[model samples]
Target: MTPHNELRLLPWSGPDGKPCYLSTDTTGGPLSRLADHAESAQLAASTELLEHAREVLVDETSDPEELRLLATDLTCALRDALRVAASRGHRLPETHASGHGGDAGPSLPAAAFG
Candidate 1:
């Protein structure tokens, strides 16, 4: 993990204006390492879930309800990953009008996820 001083969590708005998370660490510390691990896990899980969803979507014999459930699960996992990334101060590029950028000041609240 990067040093606490080097970590910067940029906030992005969520459904309820919740902060989006990202992190940038030049020196990998324990915390940064942990965050990296968490990120990798989330990424892998997301990929797996998405692939499952796709397979379900393409499987003509698959139950529609199961496909829906898988999609929902994928969405939830993605949201959780985003939250975790935000909590770690990972940088997230602004994609919407209300996104944090430019003169919007700090992207995330200093107290976010603390």
Candidate 2:
């Protein structure tokens, strides 16, 4: 199943003053969705790398260097995806007391992600 389907994500304001989400599941109460998104993308990229690695392993004359290159490519992709995703959200405290709260309170912007 798609990773998005397996979790519940709530809109949230990120460090960039943009809208993002906090994800949750049946088990974990609430977690950062950006992290989840990054992880999912990383997994997909890693899976693709594994496929390429397998192809290299199958070729009798394939050099071990090819596998190393594939690993490096996978690592780069994963890192970039994670960086992008993690930057999309900001962490805020779970609650705010009245009187101290103001118009500047953290909130998820409507179009931040899009």
Candidate 3:
């Protein structure tokens, strides 16, 4: 089993809105693959939303209602992007700071920004 610090942070939350984690020795498991696909889709959606936001920002005729809707979408996209980043960051392998074997330092929590 993977250590507590090494558990994978799933891309989606639970029914109660709490963060979810996966503990497995291999990354090729079904759950891991599902999380991978979900993360990829989320990142793509965020990228597309960014382009739309840029277009709206450049359009001087955009109304207050449109801007408000855009803000809501951007907020959702930002949340997903942050979750993906946190998940990937946690999975990153620890590295030595110098030639000598030593702890690189404490890692950021998987849900630090959640």
Cα displacement (Å) at residue 75, model 1: 1.1
Residue pairs with colliding backbones in model 3 are none
Clashes of each: 14, 3, 0
Model 1 bad stretches (over 4 Å):
1-27, 84-114
Worst 10 residues of 3 by lDDT: 1-10
User: Cα lDDT of all candidates, in order?
Assistant: 0.63, 0.56, 0.90
Compared with the true structure, what per-residue lDDT tens digits does model 1 show for residues 9-29?
432344887653444445365
Q: What is residue 30's positional error in candidate 3, in angstroms? A: 0.7
Please provide, for model 2 over 1-114, each residue's C-alpha lDDT reduced to its tens digit, 9 standing for 90 to 100: 223323222333368855454444332333564455556766686678768877887898877787778778877776555554544332322354467544455667889868
Most accurate candidate by TM-score:
3
Question: Best candidate per lDDT, number?
Answer: 3
TM-score of 1: 0.50
Q: Model 3, stretches more than 4 Å misplaced?
A: 1-5, 100-114
| Residue 56 C-alpha lDDT in model 3 | 99
Root-mean-square deviation of Cα positions for candidate 3 versus the true structure, in angstroms? 6.2
Models sorted by lDDT, best on top: 3, 1, 2
lDDT of 2: 0.56
lDDT of 1: 0.63
